[model samples]
Target: MKKICLTIIMGLVIVFLNGCEKVLEKTPDGQTTIDKVLNDFARSKGLIDAAYNEVYQARDQIAFVFSPLESLTDNAFWAATYNPYRWHNGSLSLSDPVITWDWSSPNDQLWSDFWRGIRLANNAIKYLPQSTVITEEQRAEWIAEARVLRCWYYMQLLEFYGPMPWIEEPIEPNYAGWNELVRPGYDEIVTRLESELLDVINANIFKPRVGAVDAKRVTNGIAYAIRARLLLYNASPLNNPENDRTKWQRAADAAQDVIDLPSYRLVPMSEYKRLFIGANTTPVDEIIWRAWTDNSHINNTNGVDVGSYPFASISHMWNCGESPSQELVDAFEMTNGALPVTYNDATHTTVTVTPEAAALGYSEATGGDPYSNRDARFYINIVHNMYNYGVPYNCTEPYIIETFVGGRNGFNDVISQETQRSCPGYYSGKDKQVKYWGPGNSGEGNEPTHWVLFRLAEFYLQKAEALCELGDPDAAATALNVIRERALQPRIQDVPGFANTQEFLRERIRNERRVEYCLEGQYRFIDQRRWKILNETNRFITGMRITKGGNGQFSYQRKKIRDYQSYTDKYLVMPIPLEDAKKMTSMLQPKAWQ
Candidate 1:
């Protein structure tokens, strides 16, 4: 009996061991040398795949970085209705200070993650020499792709942190110490990126497929798009020390290069809203480069959650975090090359507030043609009371609104529970999935839509701005007209007010960017910075007074006019994190920041 028991135990042990082997079989071996690990097909692909992974990782975090900056200045969101944590109290230090608060050193995760991407690119470039299986042509293509990614990473850092320490080599602790490092100037970084991008373009290296989605991957078009963007930024007032006209020309040329590519095209006007809603099969012409995500990718679960309204039901939903400001809504021009009549003081001629409109919470009178004679892009991009619920509406130059909620009288408060429903406003429709609904009635789900990082439309807009800045109003007008024609908006005879000069065109271009890129998270503080208008733009709240009535009616009262103050110089470029500053002896804090 004892012998029989031993035999059974040994059999069980063998089964258990076999199961363990299967589980551990694919586990990466630490004993493998770096050279061998890189040469391994799976490992090499994995490392390359990591570059794409960083794209999604970066995309998820982009809102956090951009929201505060965008909110600080007028772009798409209102400052009065939203909390003033970052704007008033300078609490942005809690998240990142490099661009907002001046508490943290520059060596935070923003810098670290950017460098991580750069390092991965470097590793791929370095290992290409050892990759015997990959041909010279193939190797050159791979390296070019990697270089584009590295330039993109650097571009992000350059935009936010200004000049940063240039790192082309993979991190090797044994080879060097942190003391040896120093920050490169903005011009030098731009020059280096431009040089690398030239190689990327000349080599004709990139995935050929038009609609392929890979967040961590770079394509030839993406490289050109990056070059276009970098040159545009470099030509901006922030970076251009000498006011170089050639920089603007370079930007226009780069943008035009991408536009000339047949593989790129704009999405149909009818499908514009659907393109950003969720996983789309139709290839959009506007999207030049996007970080690809599907059901299996990291952060895919939270994709819809991040973009949608945080409400229980679509019908009764309130915007969660991102609320569009009245400023941006007003920026949209009428279809006939004129500002919307809502901005006209004469529109206030009717003054009747209905109970439903009161409950729905809108200060503006209801029943007037709010949607009529408006820009087509406005209807495509924004969702107001009229568009919500089962409202059937036909959008065109003459938009016919069949269903209009919150009529002139009843005011509806649309701020989410996070804000205690105190702030009432229309939500920006740029990122959220329109059809998305949840069990709790919240607008959160795994939205299958890919986030567009670069696009042809933006390139056109950039070229227009650059051309205008370079004293070529005719060229600028032509570029702007291309985008306007696609939008189906009426083209102005001469870019409104800017008949011939670059100065007038520059203003028009800036306004165009605000309208075209609204809620795409572009204008915001960066616009303020580039225009050197940060100090002049408003950034303070007088007081917020709430009045609650017995009939479930609430009112928000504020001072009509209030003075605004700008933060210190240290607030201009975010302060290096204090902890990181301690780690790096060579790091210097922004002036005037503690």
Candidate 2:
């Protein structure tokens, strides 16, 4: 019986989540009996936590995701040649560890890891209901958490790889072979998620929330947020080529459900950046879900590494990681609520400042203090030329960051030394919770950190997007304005010469998502794909050339950093790994990959 139980434990592949540290006293007893796991509340709860651990971070899992998924999008560029560059550099293939999710190397393959999570959840859903020791209330709550996590994992799978095989329960040991596990249709996946998973979660089967103590743990809010996000993706032009208003309505309604949740509210503008820095340490009012671990905090780990990544003089990072793009820099509106540069095309030429912005005496032209007087969010999000960067991990105060060729944080054209100096002319201030650790430490104080996943702000944007798709730009404007209000920017209705046409409003909402959520996650990467605008947006990552003159003045020239040669169709959805797909005889690759 002991041998049989050990097999079940090993075969099930259950690993615990973020809070498991408190659950364990010392090294886990490898010889513990399975009956304890089944009957003991703590052990059984750990099984459910395993499902949460399997879900990888889309933001920054340095070794796991190479660079944050932003490297694959126009938001930022990762100077070092890592896995993300492999995809756009034409070296991506099925054999890559990222695709295969090689267990030996502990990779983050969307395919294998998600299934492993599903299987773990299947085991939890199976055994948790049979618990003899825990109360019915405890059982219901724990099991509900597992169910939502399983569905959320599937939602991510759908986002990355399109439709997938639907599995409701654990597979029997001698169940149907791999050949039987073929892909299903997109509609089938969506319907099943809506009817089976999302409906149940929305009905509040779980606790009101996981709460502040475990802010990173999955919650009912997260389930609702993911449902809305998935529906929005489903209604996007890429998925809803037929322009189905029904899909758009569903997305809108789902987003509205999130807004109706009583426990959450957008943190005031004062508390905005506090969401990522763990500054409050209390549950952030806006955050619904976040990534958490004992050792590493989300405090701008993206550029925190002061070692290799140019810009931050405070972090102790090993690799030259992600830095923001000039294209992203230009996305921020001026303080007067107009784009600083109006572009005629994606080529980024044929540009001029908007009359409204120009009238305010703002010019992003080649040279002369262009970084000043931008949107309120711009100062928080970017570290541009002649900007001050804050809080080195080892220091208590902020420092000036220079992006000139030979300045403190140098900007250069050489590819190999990309990490030595920033590839992009500017660094993302928001992504760097701390500039560096040792090089620029003030030796005064320390800061807190956390990772925000689902926040109330995103749902508002989703509602706005869905409303825009449903031909209700007026209602969409209301939702869009909520976000703008927090940013201290003027409402859409107040912008000069504003038109509420669906075409114009849609661009406003999309750009809102771009600037508001930049460096937060893979939202921009997936947003461009879902909207089918990848070709236009992913082509060129632009940078600025800052040359300092004899008078110690810096002149700025916008230049194309690299032409992304591989922004072709296969990127619409990642290709199924060849080895993994072959196991299922009839599996279909995404249309573009095929």
TM-score of model 1 relative to the true fold? 0.74
Candidate 2: stretches off by over 4 Å: 1-36, 62-66, 97-108, 208-214, 279-281, 294-301, 304-320, 344-346, 364-367, 391-398, 417-420, 435-445
lDDT of 1 by residue, 395-418 (tens): 112211111122321222432223
Task: Report how far residue 361 has shifted in candidate 2, in Å.
Answer: 3.2
- Tens-place lDDT per residue, model 2, 413-490, is 865433635687777656354432546532224354445668899999999999998899899999999999889899
C-alpha RMSD (angstroms) for model 1: 11.1
Q: Where does candidate 2 have its weakest 10-residue lDDT segment? A: 1-10
Per lDDT, the best of the predicted structures is 2
CA shift at 168, candidate 2, in angstroms?
2.0
lDDT of 1 at 560: 17
